[model samples]
Each structure stands twice: as structure tokens, then as C-alpha cells.
Target: MVVPEHRVFDPASSDDRSIYDRLVELGGVHVFDTTATQLHSLRALLPTPPEDVLGEEVRWVHYPWRRSLVRVLGPRGFRLLRLDRNRNKITAAEQDDMARLCVGVVGLSVGHAVAHTLAIEGLCGELRLADFDDLDLSNLNRVPASLFDLDINKTVVAARRIAELDPYMSVVPYPDGLVESTFESFMDGLDIVIDECDSLDTKLVLREHARRRGIPVVMETSDGGILDVERFDLEPERPLLHGLLGDLDASALKNITPEQKAPLAARILDPSKLTPRMLASVPEIGRTLSTWPQLGSDVALGGASVAAVVRAFGIGTPPPSGRIRINLDAHLAAISEVEPTASGESISPANQPR
Candidate 1:
């Protein structure tokens, strides 16, 4: 929808004392703070208020900020004002357009961070989140959660976090994860989809469905903050993984065991590009861990990267299809293991911490 441009009278504006008078008369409220945030109401963003103004319409909206509730009022007294804290960073026009788009994300392991990043940055106005997994003690490292969140579904936790940040943004949680029953509703009307799921088959299925609908999918890899964009919307014939996994159709990926997943994933990701630790662990799948290694630091970086990429795509300036690998190791110094020197004495390398 084209957002109609109309002049808004700010109650706090030096040029508009009439606006403040009108607000006081209409039982409107404004934040008591000196920071001059625009007065807003429960229907702050709505195009128009209903004819029957309920008794609650006179009530001041109390927003939970910091440690207390901050009471603020609406700006719909004499003029329609738009609430935008993003300012020059995100233009009012862009924000208006962004508010219409729906973005869905699957998996709340690493995806929890992605959900947080997007919601906080206002990159997506509506987020449909799916994940059957509950928060474990291990998830605290990467998921931006506290001990209080343990035992709760990751999707529910993420939704609460987003609500805390931006209550105006809509967040729908799928506690059961994405299943055949919820597929259509989850993907419906979404401009783009985020695939951060751990399962290979699910990822393929998501991409396949998204491709058919001409909806682009953005996936962030945990190791190196790799941003994978399959612009199936622009290039409908483009294969999943950019056709890297040749002839590895959805049928081949379905019903596969973890042991079977190891080699196939190695091909799609090019095992040479994987970290030494991850590369070593893939072969030990049945013997050791059931899933790939993931780090909190990498998940954080990947989440941030996805937020930026989604904004670009949402604004119609999407990055080209391919991988953009951002390796933190290149920037931050990491410890190296001791190795045997030429003389056979064990020694630490220059990069290794003493």
C-alpha cells in the first residue's frame, strides 16, 4: 500500500502548541520523559480509528522501558503522526514499505539470534518463527537467552524478546516446528523466508517450496557467517545450493540418517572450506555428535549478517546470489595448538597463546 503523505502535528513541536491543547482535550497521553518521543496510542500505526472509541481509548499506553512503565499518549488528536525511532537511518518511506512484508524463519537454535537481530533492527515487521526445540542449558551460549528461558520453546522465547523490543511488529510462533499441517500458513504472503534450520532435508524442502512460489530464501551458515541467497524469485530455474549439489534432489535428501547426511553435506559445503574441528567431527558422526558443530560467536555474527541481508532484500536491493564468507579468525587472533618442531621438541606456534 502506498503510504499517503500527510502533515503531522507534534504536541512537543515548538511550532504547534495547538496540537498539545487538542491532545489534552481528547484525553490523549504523552510520555513524561524530556526526550520528545512522539505521542502514540494503541492504534498509533493504524490508518484510522474506529467510529466507536472504546472506554480503553482514554487510557494511556504504559510501555515497559528499563525498569519501569513509561506512559505515552497517541498523536491522533488533530493530525496523523507516524512513529519512527529509526530516523535518517531507516527512512519513513522505507519503514512504511517494510511494515507490509512478512518474513518467516525456521529453526530457533542459531535462528534464535537471527530472530532477535532482525526484530531489534526493524529489518522485518512481521516474523513467522518455527522451532519444536526447547531451550536447553547449552543454548545460553548462542541464543541470547537467560536461565529463566530454559524449558520454554525457542520460538516462544524469541517471540517474547521481539515483543519486548518492538510490540508493534507482529510475531507468530510455531512451537511444533514446520510440519505439513503448518506449511501453507507459515509461508503464506511472506516476501522472503529465512532458512536457519539444522536438518538438511528440511532446508531442501523449504527452498523447493520457496522456489516454486518465487520467494527468495536467505540462509546463514554458522562457521564463517556465510550468507547464502538463492534468488529463486529472479532465477526460477536455479537449483538449490546454486546447483552445487547436482542431482541431489529432494527425494535423495529425504529420510536420510545423520551418518548419511555427513558426506552429502560435505559435498554441498565443500569439505575443504570447513573448519579443522568441524571437518574432523563430520566423519565421527555416528561415533560422536549427531549434528554439526556450532559456535555461539559464529551464530551471533551470522544473525547480524542475516539481518543486514534481509533488509537489503526487503528494500529491493538484494545482494547477488552467492556466498559471502566473513571469517572472524582473519580479524581476531585465535589460539593454535602445540606442534612438533623440526628438532622433534613440541613447541607452540606464534599464533598460539603462551
Candidate 2:
């Protein structure tokens, strides 16, 4: 029998490693994108290193995980203790409350951004992540990942990113993707569910399950920065897809093709609200491109935006429930004038802004 990961990893140990010890241990920490990090010797960095809780002469500690042995700086509890500034926005009590939240994120393409943002804000205590897809060069357009992460399973990639940010955050990854057996468990105790998966079947099924349990669901679509919120807890009998999927049954949704999903997406999201480019591209998907167009900015903002809404929910002040659209094209669209050539032709690349 396969043992569940929770049974194997001690939560208390993970907390200690992240908070008190060197997070970088040879193989456990990797160098990606930029140049390899060069750290001064531990003693050199801290000329007069402070002692640990024991009050003994203390310095560095070896990281607990991974195959290779490596050592680096401190049992830095002092630095962690000095995070009073975080208390300015999130009160000490609220910070503690944030740590108790259990969030479920399905689909890592956009979910990775959501997961990483939550960790940075010290939001989730436990994250239940599900994704079956593998990263490719194409994924870099949205996911804030390195070329090194290419080909890695999306769930695992999100888990690793979460760990790097908040080691204390317990991340349970569904690398095989969400299926029948584990589906129920995935929904059991989530404070909120962030649904970004493409599978229409899973979307409906998840909303049904979450609605029954009174858990709210939030979704961010790729185009025009559209975010849909279903407060199923407040409106228990709310229909799936806000009753958009009323006629269709779950079986019809199973193993659905992209062609089958297009009209449905257009319906729920409203084709009129779709960008002109996206509206035009939908018909030529298979011919011009393999999938829909999404940018790193949109996905990143989507995650951060979800974190803000969820943070409000976690603390006592819940945000207004409904669709929220942060229009990037409208807000951050570039304004530039074409450089004129001596002959009134196109200018050279060198003439463009650096």
C-alpha cells in the first residue's frame, strides 16, 4: 500500500528547517535562471553570531532533507522574531489565523501563481494542490518558472515553490491529477477552493461538492483578467456555473474535447466581454495556435488577486462576492509612437526604447 505523505513527513520538522536552519542544502536548493549564488562563509557573514535557544555558542546548521550533505548559516530565529512589520498589516492574531487556513488549488498553470502568492503573504497553513500536466517551454509565458522547471509535473512544481517560500506551509500534491478516489478528500476541509482547471467536468463536480459543504469557490479565467466567485456557502442551492451547466450532466463533461469546451466557455464567460484578439483566435485554435493566449502578467495578477480576496475571507472581513476583472490591457497597455525613418519607412531595432 502507498503511504500518504503526511504520515511520512513530520510537520514540526519541516517548520524547524524553514524557520531555524539553512534552507539551502546541496541538492535540496537549486540555482535557476540567474548566476549561481555566492555566499560568504557563515562566520564571515556573521562576525559575531548569536547563540540559539540553548544559549550555547551557536552558528550554522546542516539542512535536514536531501541526499547530499551541505552546511550554511544560522538558526536564525532572531531574524524571524523581528518581523513586527508584517504585524502592521496583518495583526499578530490575524497572522496566526492565516496560518490555520486550508486552501485547495486545482490546476497549476495559474494555480502556481496563487500558491506562491499565498505563501509569500503567510496565508495558507496547508495547501491541497492538484495538477496532472507537465511544464513545457510554452508554460513559461504564464508560470513564474525557470527553464529548469520544464517537464516537471505542475503539482510538484507548485509544491516546491511553496516550500521554498514558507517551509512550514504543508502542501499535499496530487501529481497524478485529481481523480475519483482522492476527489472527496481534496474537498473535505478546504476553507476556500481556487478553481483554475480547464476540465469542465471537474469544475462542475467541484462546485457541487463545495456547495454541499458550504465552501466558497473562486475562479480566474485567462482572458481579460476575469475572476468569478461563487459564494456557495452563503447561497447553498446555487446552480453549478450559476445554472449555466444546468442542462448538462457530469458524464457529458467527462473526457471532453477542446472543441466541445469552446461554446461552454464562451457562454459562462460571455463572448462579448472577451478581447477582440481572443474572440478572433477561438475559431482558429487548432490551426494558428495549440491553445488560448495567456500572459505571465495576467496569471500572476490573478493569483495575487485571489490571495487578497481569500485573505479577506480568512480574516473576518470577507470581500464582496462576484466577478472582478482587473483589466491589464486597459490599465497597463503600452503607449508608444512609431519612430519615423528618413524615408518615412520603418525604423531600425536600435531606435526602439532599451
Candidate 3:
């Protein structure tokens, strides 16, 4: 009968004795027999076979000493020796690339969902989370936070939760979300920027900065199930957000107070830049907003999906960028390859003289 390797019997512990006796009664022999000759013979069998092969012998036989040894030693133990017996789905190169990626996520509401998904997918190494807002009763409706987190700042909540999930991960939290004062500090050393902020001006500012630095910017708008990607790397000169405002330059647009920027940016719709049919549909869209509030589930799903795409991008995986739109309501998704142009070639979307 072939015996397993790395088995030790502890006679001092009652629990160990009970386990040993049960195994012995079940026709199991300890790998190291007590006979003096057996000890010399087993020692002669130096450099034992691989742990997986040895593990199979003891798989059915439970010995507290061996189990405890394996538990304490981790992968050095019998069970962990068999871990490589299974095939690896992800290639070593891909894992290496994922390990090197550092992504910064802005806005913890939907951003948390994105970060959670990326961590689960094993795509990010370091995550810089920025958010000024605190957890409120209203946030629980859509964010990943628990009811117990109410009233705590969002950055603190996200950092704590993510740390618990992945203790090895590096999470840098900026309790204050991006602002003109904090912009320079936030943009430093980020590989990719995720624009989950609720302000259009903030999005524009982020896009400009990303464009200037040749960083890619991805934005998800839950209202229309839109996942827009501005690959500044591909088209450094293209106006940000696909020139959504038609001809209005950021400077030409009415100067908005910081307090008013959030909501006004949300409601500001540049109809001219949209397809004529879509432009006509705006009135209908307005009516829908007046009649029914946007569903939280829809927004949450949008955020999560966009985050997945971004993770794929970060890990050397191709993302469906260049203006990709996925409309859950219509079950339609499309991608448009944008052509790069000179920065001053076209009039600012908002500044096109009417």
C-alpha cells in the first residue's frame, strides 16, 4: 500500500490522537511507520515525489497533524501542491500586464461598482479613488455601501470596503473629489481616467486634461445607456465628448458657478451635435424626464458595464472604444471609429455661432 508523504503524528494532543486512531482503524498507515527499520527506509526515500501525487494518497485520510501543517504552511502543504494540477485560464503575460496597471476612478457611487468588478476580474493593481460626497440615505439606493455607512464620506467608505476585499491592493482615497484646486494632484501618475462624475463641466475639464496628456477617458451616461470613450491617444485633436455641444467652446459657454455647474451640466443638452432625429427626440426625452424619474438599476448597470470595458482596456485587452453605445432598453449597441483632426480644425460644439 502506498502511503502519503509529509505526515506527522502528534501524540501530545488528544484531538490528534483521536484523528490518528480513526485513520488507523480505517486501514490507513501513517507515512512514517514507528519501526526503527521503517524510519531508515523512509529517510532513504529522500526528495519525495510531487505534493499533488502524494496528496492524492492522503486525500481521503484525515490526519490533524498533517492538516494543521498544511494549513499553517499554506501552499507548502499537500493540498496546495496540487493547485497547479488545474489548467490556467489566464496567461502569465496577461496577468503580468494586469499587475502593472494603475487606474484612477472618480466618483464612488457608480465608481465603486466599477472598482469592485475590476478587482474581481483581477485587472487592477493600484486604484486611486476620489470623491467629495459622503454617504447619504439617497446614495444607498444606487451605491455599493451598506446602511451602516450612512453619513461617512464616500472616499472613506470605499477605501475601507475595498481594503477588506483585497488587503494587498493599494487604495489611495481623496475625500475631496476633483476640483480646480485638486485637479493637478488627482491627475498625477494615473494610467486611465474614468469619468463617473455627474458634472458635464468636470467631464470636459477631465477630457481636456487627458487629451493634453494623451490619456484615454471613458464616460458612462446612464440616461441613454451610453458608454463613450475618447481615445486621446488615437485622436489628440478631436474635441472632447465627440464635440457634443456642436460649436460652443468651453470658455464661450455661460460661466457657471461651481454650485450650479453640477445640475446645469446635467441638464445642458446640446441638440445640434446630435443626429437631427435625435435632436427632435429631445422634446420627447424632456417629457419622459418630467413624467418619470430615471431608474437607479439602469444607472447602476451602466456604471458596472462601463467599468468592465475599462478593466479590459487596462489589462491589454481591447475595449469597444471610439464612441460605443449600449442601449439596454433597445438591446442595441454600436461603435464608431472616430477620425482624429487638428485641435483648431473644428469650431467648439457650444461656440458655433448660431
TM-score of each: 0.72, 0.75, 0.60
Q: How high is the lDDT of residue 104 in model 1?
A: 90
| Residue-pair clashes per candidate | 3, 0, 13
> Model 3 reaches what TM-score against the true structure?
0.60
Which segments of model 3 are wrong by more than 4 Å?
Answer: 1-89, 247-294, 332-354
Best candidate per TM-score, number?
2
Candidates 2 and 3, the one with greater TM-score: 2
RMSD of 1: 11.5
Per-residue lDDT of 188-306 in model 3, one digit per residue for the tens? 77778888876555677777888888778877665556677777867879877777555555564445544444333444333334334444444553444321133567567766777
- Could you tell which candidate, 1 or 3, scores higher by lDDT? 1
Q: Over the stretch 1-354, how does candidate 2's per-residue lDDT look in tens digits?
A: 011221122224666455433444333643232101212222233233444522322232222322222222222432233223465587767877877899999999899999888877778678888888899888888898888778878887777665544444578888877788878888888999999898888898888789999999989886888888888988998777777656787778787667767777778888888989999978766667686788888898898788888888878888645787777886646545567767788764546646
lDDT per residue (tens digit) for residues 210-296 in model 1: 988999898888865667888888888888877777766676777788899889878867788887787899999877785777888
Residue 259 CA displacement from its true place in model 2, Å: 1.9
Pairs in clash, predicted candidate 2 = none
Question: Lowest summed-lDDT stretch of 10 residues in model 3?
Answer: 68-77
